[model samples]
Target: MSARVPRVLAIAGTDPTGGAGQHADLKSIAAMGGYGMSAVTALVAQNTEGVRSVHVPPADFLTAQLDAVSDDVEIDAVKIGMLGSVPVIEAVAGWLGRHRPPVVVLDPVMVATSGGRLLEPDAEDALRAVLGLADLVTPNLQELAVLAGDALASSWEEALAQGHRVAREHGTLVLVKGGHLAGDRTPDALVGPESPEPLVAFDGARVPTDNSHGTGCSLSSALATLQVRHGDWARSLRIARGWLRGALERSAELEVGHGSGPVHHFHHVQEALETWGTVPERFSDELWEVSAPVRREIEELEFVRRLGDGGLEPERFLAYLDQDLQYLDGYSRALAALAARAPAEEARSFFAAGAVSCTETEAQLHRARLRHAGLEGAGAPAGEVTRRYTTFLLAATAAEPYPVGLAAVLPCYWVYADVGRHLQELARRSDAAAHPYADWLATYADEGFQEATRTARRLLDQAARDAGPAVRERMREVFLEACALERDFFAAPAAASRLPGVVAIEYS
Candidate 1:
């Protein structure tokens, strides 16, 4: 069955400018994969510059809007924002008490960026009552000070103290934002009633952008929506903060208002849409099909055909193993580079493990085989083709993005595994008791190597899916080049044997 989308309701004031209030909340909710709904408590006349005025709707009408939504749809989460008066706050608190949505994130929109008061002086106490009903409370330094009945916190330490006090008193989680603090770093913490210390603290370099309007509203709504999906407060906060940072970094791309403009809420969504429009559904299948000629050449090579029938000379086979040892050294380094540059944890771990396996397991296999052939001490230099292939792989991983690097190295895994399986099948059909090079053939055709190749394909396919048109084109170029290089690598041993002064080295 398909997963159900979270239905999140934003009960807040309206910003026709779409930078803050319910508009920002709705955008954030949708961006985090939730179905968004909003009920306006106030019609706010505001722009990036500042708020001109706020019109509070009648308490009964606000209640009616809230009831209309809860009566029909099941709300998974709610983000409460900008209640202009006591009656409005009480009305919201009343509805919340009755229905009690699974998750409630209250963004205490008390003070604006321009230092204007959004909540009435008399309504502070009422807003506190709503805090008890919320699962999480997001408050800036000014609102935090007001809730704790203390002076404005001049430092992060003072802010945490206020957050702890508020959380302890109300028995709710408080998200303390340090953007108002003076520093190169903007820190945030999730403080709960159970502990004096914050449950989790995130330290991030402040994004240098003037278009950070409605960050608090956006963050709170994102937290509410993400909570429904993850069901873990710390995980939700981590994802929400990362998304907000991306939005802040991309905010400059937008030209919403003259003053501090709204952040680019759909930055990731827009990129994903662009990728979906351009890239094919099965990108790896296309890569394989495009490189069919190269694979056919590899299968037709004299070395591969002779090796499959167990008639290839031992000196030539040892020469190939020697070249592969040199190639694996550089290949492992390239894998390490990919690991360091990977964006996701799973991809990073996969590439890191591949690097380790290449240097240890695969290298040991080559060393043992060469030792058994009585050429253990022979130190033959890499052939021209081997040097060229390794150099190309190293350059791609060092200089290009993750996608391009991934494409350049993929052929080594895919082509080797394909050739290994084909040769294994040929050996199986032969009348001989066993293929002389059965061990080597089985190494590449085994379940472990095949699974690893499949994983590499999956990673490249995902990278292609997320990449832009220009990046995908670069990926295709590198992939085809690497495939051609694989064919040359297979033919290198025979070519080297025929060259002048190429005497086979032997152990004493």
Candidate 2:
């Protein structure tokens, strides 16, 4: 028999707006790579702003929905959210006791993102009873305080303390989220009675966006899906947190509702058409889209402007070229390592060819420059910036996964291609006469190099699409770091002084 696709079930309320409740859960489950089924306990009259009212189904109907699904289809995981009344909570808890799923992720949806009450005060006791049935209980600081019957958690320390206390009381794992805490970082800790230390801690830089309406529901659903896939709670939380962050990063791009909008759960999908122009394909449109700030800095650099105008002194250009050549030496090896680990034959061949192309391209540029500078057999050592960048590349190749290594090496190809093409276009439009660096700029901006970049992006995208949340996030981190390094490498030559041996001579 064929292996079954993991079936993740969500028992929650419905939002007509499709931003929260069962709608958000289904979206998150599918995005995290799982088949989703839902049984509605309540129908919430809600939008992005707040919940107007909730209509709970009868207890027997809720039980019937659960039985209908569990009777035929095998459930791999279950995520419970927004039990509006005591009867619904008890009914669900009763179902849980009989047909226990392999994994149960409970999002204690006591409060909404818009500061509205989702669960009634009378339902709190029933919700508490339901907690012990869950594998993990995810609660924001406010929700944790309510569940633990304590004051609000004002700090991360207090949040952890509350989590530990609640976990001990219920004999379950409690995920205390610090997203509401005032800080630059958002920290979440999973604590239980069995261990003094936290089972896992997930920390992320706070994404500055208002489109976080369905965050709790999304996270809980993603956790259920990931738990089914990896079968390890800590690893599942790590990957789920990463995916949630990506969703938040791209949330602003989605236009869902008037108030705090919903996050873009499928933000990592490849674009229908390539919109990068001369810069090549991007692994995830979200990665490239979020790189605008760095790209702006590179565009405004003095070194880039000088190169475009052909006003850069030949000595400085040579020094930059020398550093670049040195950088390429290590870069080629990283490409070979990536090829060796690539999951597909097509990706393997692509990376292998990339290594060969790097060598040939670097050699040709160095040969031409050496002949022009009257140095036939001399080699230039790598500069500090070049050494650091190549070191990072080599390490990524050796240690990180294939997709991550590809991301680390991507900026070198993309940034250079973009800068080269921009400079070439500038040279074409500007009235600069007989530019010395014109041929060099033309070489890098050629169709050959552009095609190579396109190939690299396509391979990286294939890997990224197939990778899980944790690896995809790793790819993003590496891509940003590499892009930052690219900015430094471009700026290094302009910031540093002239070469020691060569005399300073500015061309008109």
Candidate 3:
């Protein structure tokens, strides 16, 4: 809870253009509220126009630079950008092997925006060998094609398969960016060997701008900060991608460079927004009124206890899962409906991913409950239903080109933790049959899940500080509905506890 700054180490080539590379990465880290440290791999004399000259740092010096930063500073995350040749890659890989940092983001930068090559002939092999130690690797379409020895992915399925293949081979997570593919829209896939499926994509509209010079470097750096702040690299990528989208949107009006220019890295920074919380320039009484119930419910919900104990009871879990499946179905439909408004292909793809996830989760839940008698045949696709709510909330987010999708996801995190705590307290004094909450406490109690729950809230709150009041107000709206849904979800047994249908004391 203490106010502290996160420090990220960016190891990459520097661009005089300041649009992409080490320079852009540093700016992105700072812009996202993290302190940035750099170990230059190469220095390029490049402008928005393109690269003119490149200067490589000797392997030994690169080694010294990496060592000095790790020894002197408390590094939270590391972002690897362009490395000119094999020696530089080996030096970085050697240093990283020794340090064994927890969060390392490897951004494969081989093809530049101007169709210029940045790495030496042997650099690819060396870079791959050195970067085998990365926690995550982000590669654009061209890089993926090169890595796969295929000129094009041929299909979205191929892109995902290739990304997963490389991620597994490297023993790290792979983020395959579809932006460079020929299309008005692009989709990116994030996959690892450990996940359940390779198709769980983070779809976003690939922002169209010639000013997208430093995108890869900036994204990796931003992801590094999120990784540092929160251990999950997936969340970091989601945030970074969304943050980059905002940066691109804001920079569309600025004339930073004559050719490709730079994105507005400082876009979400709300220091310039005159209004703070509590005192809004355009305050609405309706907003406060609608949000009051949610605030009260949140105050009443005991998140810690719900997480600590058995969480949701078997029956309640079944019910909640059913409802969630229903929600996701609606959400998928909503996403499809909203696709026409998507600013880029990535957003449309992300919505598709969300739908796919919802459907898959619904199937998983349905199978999980198949053994149970009364609930076996009657379950609704609840995740789909939840999707409706998400899509409705997303509608409020449509006017702006930001990561409102991630924002819409916040309620799921905040509400569950809060309601789980409250639910757990009720479970503590009651027997299994008497309590409505069960499987949830065990589910939420896991250290990994708990950490995720906490980090997401912190990130969301930070996002709110700079978001427009309308957005904040919309967040409150969705949160209120979330509270109601949760309350209704729990209200079933609590309200009908004494009824014979409730079937109390059945646990023999």
Better of 1 and 3 by TM-score: 1
lDDT order, best first, reads 1, 2, 3
Query: Pick by lDDT: which candidate is best?
Result: 1
- Predicted candidate 3 versus true structure: per-residue lDDT over 1-508, tens digit per residue: 1136678888888787677888898899998788988999988888888788888967899999999998888787788988888888888878877886767888988967866688886777777675468888888877877665566687777888788777767777888887777666767678786652653477666676777878888888888887777776666667787888888877876677788778889877554743664444423233336656765655454432342344534544455445555555555555454454445565556555545655675446554654343545224433333444555555644553243433555455556655555555656765555343355354545565456556545544555655676777666655566556554443332221221122441210
TM-score winner:
1
Alpha-carbon runs more than 4 Å astray in model 3: 1-4, 194-196, 270-508
Following a full C-alpha superposition, what root-mean-square deviation does model 1 have from the true structure? 10.7
Q: Write the per-residue lDDT of candidate 1 for residues 23-107, one digit (tens) a residue.
A: 9999999999999999999998889988898889899999999999999999999999999899999899889889999999999
- lDDT for residue 31 in candidate 1, whole number 0-100: 93
Per-model TM-score, in order, reads 0.58, 0.55, 0.53
Residue runs of model 2 more than 4 Å from their true location after superposition:
1-4, 272-508
lDDT by residue (tens digit), candidate 2, 94-129: 899999999999999988998778898998988998
Off by over 4 Å in 1: 1-3, 277-508
